[model samples]
Target: DVILKCDAYDGFTSNNSDENDNVGNPSLQYDIGINKCWKAVGPAHKQRYLEYTDEHISVKDDPIKTSVKGNNTSNAPKVEQTNNNHPSIVAGKQLSQIQTSLFQSLPFARYLNLITSLGQPLGHHSQTRRFRPGL
Candidate 1:
């Protein structure tokens, strides 16, 4: 299990709440009952994550509201606003969107390519097609 350490008093605010659950009180601990086997659930979660990042990076067909798109693959997972605290829409997480662009544009592209090829050989991409960077 991963433990997130947050600022003492500030951690309890709604800004720091889990995206799925809006409860901000950090002291209160509860597990979200995702009733699915790990094998079935993990890939779906990973796909959603990949979709979120991809959509924000690709330039969308609009003027004022400049959004991004992925490779526009027909099977790409759709990003949903199921959570009020979704990182894509949250102020604190906006920097992550910028980071994604830099990750692709700068010298990191070679590393990303290498990592993708390595993961493919290990059958890591077998779980989810969303991991395909340009696809």
Candidate 2:
């Protein structure tokens, strides 16, 4: 079990309320019910278990190398030579047009609200927040 302390007032709100007085306040008692698992083991047993698991699993290759084609240079000339193919050009133009239309249809204010409400940082501030145990 853990207890967390936080500021009384909501940081995002601009309301002029008494921010310091949080004693017996109904708004401050927010409880999140998290189910946890506790295990009892010695340090040597834990180390042995970790080592056995590590030995059994195969090491993963770099994700980028696996996803991208290695023979890109050899394929480039052939792709360029087939530039006159009407189907590929038509497909590319259609895809671009669809992308532009989709982006244009999205509401800017709604997108901004969604991002802010989800605790995503704005501007040059860090995009990630350090997650604490009880946050």
Candidate 3:
């Protein structure tokens, strides 16, 4: 039996309309993957059942094979590959679709404001600097 576990974290914000936008701060997304298999023993002391766990494999490089916007192949010319990479292509398309949806639904302006605030000075006193009182 083989077992594998993977975890990932992601954060993002959009700068668009305030309505239907995620407020408070950038949202965090977490995902986990597990792969395993187990064998069951029957009441008679014999092996009866075999269970195979789901597995998720990730492709580090470009996964899309079709020329579509937001896809890995969006910028490359269509060419024939000597080997088949359909699984990767399908995964890439799904990932790209999810990212596109998230981006499209983000509130652009407020998100930009959050980013800008990070660089600005903090504290209430920072907003007011005492100039020459007599001037």
Worst 10 residues of 1 by lDDT: 31-40
Model 2 clash tally, residue pairs: 0
lDDT of 3: 0.27
At residue 44, what lDDT does model 1 achieve? 35
Going through the candidates in order, what is the number of backbone clashes in each? 2, 0, 7
Compute the lDDT of residue 87 as modeled in candidate 1: 28
Rank list by lDDT = 1, 3, 2
TM-score (C-alpha) between model 1 and the true structure: 0.21
Q: Please list the residue runs of candidate 1 whose C-alpha ends up more than 4 Å from where it truly belongs after superposition.
A: 1-9, 12-26, 29-94, 115-135
TM-score of each: 0.21, 0.23, 0.22
Clashes of 3: 7
How far does residue 77 in candidate 1 sit from its true spot (Å)?
Answer: 26
TM-score order of candidates, top first: 2, 3, 1
Error of 3 at 103 (Å): 2.1
Write out the backbone clash pairs for model 2. Answer: none
Candidate 2 deviant stretches above 4 angstroms: 1-76, 81-85, 108-135
